[model samples]
Target: MRAPIKTTLLFSMLSLCMSCSNTTALNKGKEKLKARFEVAGICSNYTFSLIEGMADTSLVAASWTNPQSDSTYTNAFGVKNPCDLPEGLKVGDEFYFEIDSNRPNRCMVCMAYYPTPAKKLNIKVLEIVKE
Candidate 1:
């Protein structure tokens, strides 16, 4: 009886150690993926009103409140721009926009939203121009 109890305790400890190791490996993989991909910014262009259109096309819209400042920016999304964003974005809102790397003046897509304002949002993408 004493021997059986000791064996069970040893097995349980080994199982628990293996489980912890697997969890650590999974967390490392997640961290690697996050580091490889950039989070352009939050999408701030899809507000509550514009959610219908985004839904029509199968897109997601959400509002976030800044924990630090207690300010809110509605409908934030991610974009590929890596610059000093506009004032609205500076306030912790993210803008989703499309850009043609070849043509700086043309933005193929544009979406802007703010949560507290509770306004309509629109996202438009221009047709691809053939060379």
Candidate 2:
């Protein structure tokens, strides 16, 4: 009886380990396909808009909107809030920004996944144009 109990415990541990490994592998694959964006040359005191694709509208849209204005400056895919990004971004989502580039600064956007929560990617802006 003791031997049987030990064997069952060992099997259960092994199964748990296997399940964890599978989840890790899946996350890695998802990360590999994640998206990244960057923008540079933003002048100070200006605003920008970030847009992400809308495929599964069910997924929450996360963004950081300027408090004084009605424009969204930063955004992340698969996240309900801009502050929830974990790392890099997922593919297919688009981000638009209107930055104040009087001084050089960096902006980023990305996608979110479970366990990690969200993946934020850095966006490098080569130039900031006025329209």
Candidate 3:
């Protein structure tokens, strides 16, 4: 019984790994959008917002609260940074990025009732264009 369970677990893990790899491979050649970091969200789901029209297509979601967008937030528009931001990156960083639906796996961020961009996108920072 124990052996069978172990084998099943192993196979399940292997399957998960394979699926993840496939997702990464299939995400290639996606449209790259230019945006600037607006501000981190109140929680995991609404982690952050961008000032680019391309990614700011959150029709039903809460629009940005930054001066460049909503103008009610405390953040600003400056450098080039995208989602999945680097460790050293900060708000206002500008950069070209590709949306990664397979990344930043769904997670909670703040109060479910609190407002957040309806289409909170996952981003894979391709390159920082901050000068």
Q: Sorted on lDDT, highest at the top, how do the candidates line up?
A: 3, 2, 1
lDDT of 1 by residue, 12-122 (tens): 999999999988865542321100111222443222212112222222234545344464433433332323234332321222332222323223334443223222222
What's the lDDT for residue 59 in model 3? Answer: 25
What shift in Å separates residue 120 of candidate 3 from its native position after superposition?
0.5
Q: Candidate 1: global Cα-lDDT?
A: 0.34
TM-scores of all candidate predictions against the true structure: 0.27, 0.27, 0.46
Ordering by TM-score: 3, 2, 1
lDDT digits (tens) for residues 1-131 of candidate 3? 89999999999999999999987777553567666654554443222444454433332133445333455522222222232467665557777767656574444333543343434455677787758
Worst 10 residues of 1 by lDDT: 31-40
Minimal lDDT window, size 10, model 2:
39-48
Root-mean-square deviation (CA) per prediction = 14.8, 12.7, 9.9
Q: Which of the predicted structures, 1 or 2, would earn the higher lDDT when compared with the native?
A: 2
**Candidate 3 TM-score versus the reference:** 0.46
